[model samples]
Target: MRTVLVLTVSLLLFSCSPDTDDERIGISGDSFLIFGHFFGECIGEGCVETFKLTESQLLEDTIDDYSGQQLNFEVLSDALYQQVRDLPDFFPLELLNEKEAVIGCPDCADGGGLFIVYSKNGTQQSWRIDQSKGNVPVYLHDFIDQVNARIALINQ
Candidate 1:
């Protein structure tokens, strides 16, 4: 009888573990991508636009703050999500292994700046890339273009 009871308790404990539940898996478990552009010198509603893209949904920062640190997010409309659904596909794999978090001087000349935060598996990395084509690495050109296009689509 004691053996039976122990088995049942073990089963229950294992079942309740977070690893056993698929629905419990969230942004932390899977990959999440955050991309945005900020202009420190600019004023108005369009100056700061940031987005968090998860496997299941897309969220936009409601605070509109210039900093790329922690920002509040709200789920974007389904229509808006669709417009940038492929944005993640454009991410450069090389960036995942890059050491520098800040590439070149971002927004140094008021030319604006782009930021990306990508988390996958157990690694989370962020980068602040210069808006100018010449300032950033050549590998990031296509990704930057794609980001810009998606941002335009979302704003439209």
Candidate 2:
């Protein structure tokens, strides 16, 4: 009887313990999205604007370079963050499965370019999209518009 009680208690304790599997924990983790626009020939602080959006906060990249390769971020004000917090939800899932990381000639002619990085379920994908509507896939036009609109909103 004592052995049975001990076994039952041990089983209960193990069952109640939090899961420690990294894969399982990662599955429930919040996804992250990073997006921004850059103009190689532009001047001014707004020339290269980028942002990182998480499940709870919006962060603006402090780096002012035209490349999105490296970025550092600072949290934006709650009011401003709220305005673009839903931006991640608008990311098209099809882009994740795309074979091309770059859709068109971004910033090839002094035209601005859009940059995007999406992370979910332990997978990450990024893209460099042309600012010219005709230069990008038709499906991405709406998302580009949304991105431009949000950029304007924050800059305002």
The numbered model that scores best in lDDT is 1
Give me the displacement of residue 82 in model 1, in angstroms: 1.3
Put down candidate 2 lDDT per residue, 20-139, tens digits, no spaces. Answer: 442121212567788889898887888899987777778899876577877889999888878987675566656666799988889998898999888777677889999998887777
Q: 57-129, model 1: which lDDT tens digit per residue? A: 8899998877776699999888888788777667777777689998878899998889888887867789999
Q: What is the lDDT of residue 144 in candidate 1?
A: 87
RMSD over all Cα atoms, model 2: 11.3
Taking all chains together, each candidate's TM-score versus the true structure is 0.78, 0.78
Clashing pairs in 1: none
| Residue 124 CA displacement from its true place in model 2, Å | 1.5
Instruction: Evaluate model 2: give its TM-score.
Output: 0.78
List lDDT for all candidates, in order.
0.83, 0.80
